[model samples]
Target: MLIILTMVLFALALSTIVMFISSLLSKKTIIDREKSSPFECGFDPKGSARLPFSLRFFLIAIIFLIFDVEITLLLPLVVVTKLTFIKTWVITGTFFLLILLAGLYHEWNQGALDWSS
Candidate 1:
């Protein structure tokens, strides 16, 4: 009981010291307008929210997110292969890849992927 109590006290003291040191170190000695201003989601927080946003840029962002999610979803298949049969793994992976490719092709055909108009 005494050893545990001593350990708990030591941990609390150590953490408090570390936190104090970090707080002291992280303080900004000099403040600037650009550094102080809040920036959010590729847009200036100080700018008018009603400003026109590009539809093409939004579409490209959506496409990037879709492909990023596809990569995350496909990565689990590598780990799952050891847990499942080879035939089942291959079929599922191939089907998923084909679906992703089809969506990409459709987007390309629709000119959503084109940079120059």
Candidate 2:
């Protein structure tokens, strides 16, 4: 136990020393405007680089991600069914499905599922 503790402490101290040395050597003293600005053909930019993103598309994507994760969670239950009793598994699965349905209903009622504005 003493040897393990000593080795862990040694590793921690070594990592700290290496990180300190690397940080000290990596300091940047030069700051130039050309390096910071987006590259153009020796001319100022015409417009902002970032374009506006669609809020509806973002909402749809979030909904897709949430449902995708729920499906993954549900998939594992099929494998576990053989190991457990059928009644318990069915109850658990049904409860989870009810929660997912409730969330879907809430999103629909709130008009988040509607694409047409």
Candidate 3:
């Protein structure tokens, strides 16, 4: 226990020293304004650097990801069914599938599935 404590302390001290030295070395002596601006072939930029994002498309993507992961989880149940009794397997599968369906229904009811507003 003492040896482990000593090793951990040594590591902590070494990391702290390294971090301090790195911070001191990385300090910027001078800051330039033109260098930070977005460049456009030696000309001034016309528009903002950030682009507009579609929230509806993002919602659809998130829904697809959730359903995709849930479907993958269902794949393991195929092997589980072969190892378990018919009644238990049926009940377990039905419950899991129902959960997935219910989630889908909820999303649909909330109009999140609709692409056109």
C-alpha TM-score for every candidate: 0.67, 0.54, 0.54
Model 2: lDDT to the true structure = 0.86
Please provide, for model 2 over 1-117, each residue's C-alpha lDDT reduced to its tens digit, 9 standing for 90 to 100.
Answer: 999999999999999999999989875555555467676534446566565667888899899999999999999898888777688888999999999999999999999999998
Q: lDDT tens digits, residues 2-101, model 3?
A: 9999999999999999999998987464455556778853455756557666788889989999999999988988988878768877888899999999
Q: RMSD in angstroms, candidate 3?
A: 9.7
TM-score of 3: 0.54
Error of 3 at 71 (Å): 0.3
Preferred candidate (TM-score higher): 1 or 2 = 1
Ranking by lDDT: 1, 2, 3
Worst window of 10 by summed lDDT in candidate 1: 27-36
Distance from true location, Cα of 6 in model 3, Å: 58
lDDT of 3 at 8: 100
What TM-score does candidate 1 reach?
0.67
The RMSD of every model to the true structure, in order and in angstroms, is 4.2, 9.8, 9.7
Off by over 4 Å in 2: 1-47
Off by over 4 Å in 3: 1-49
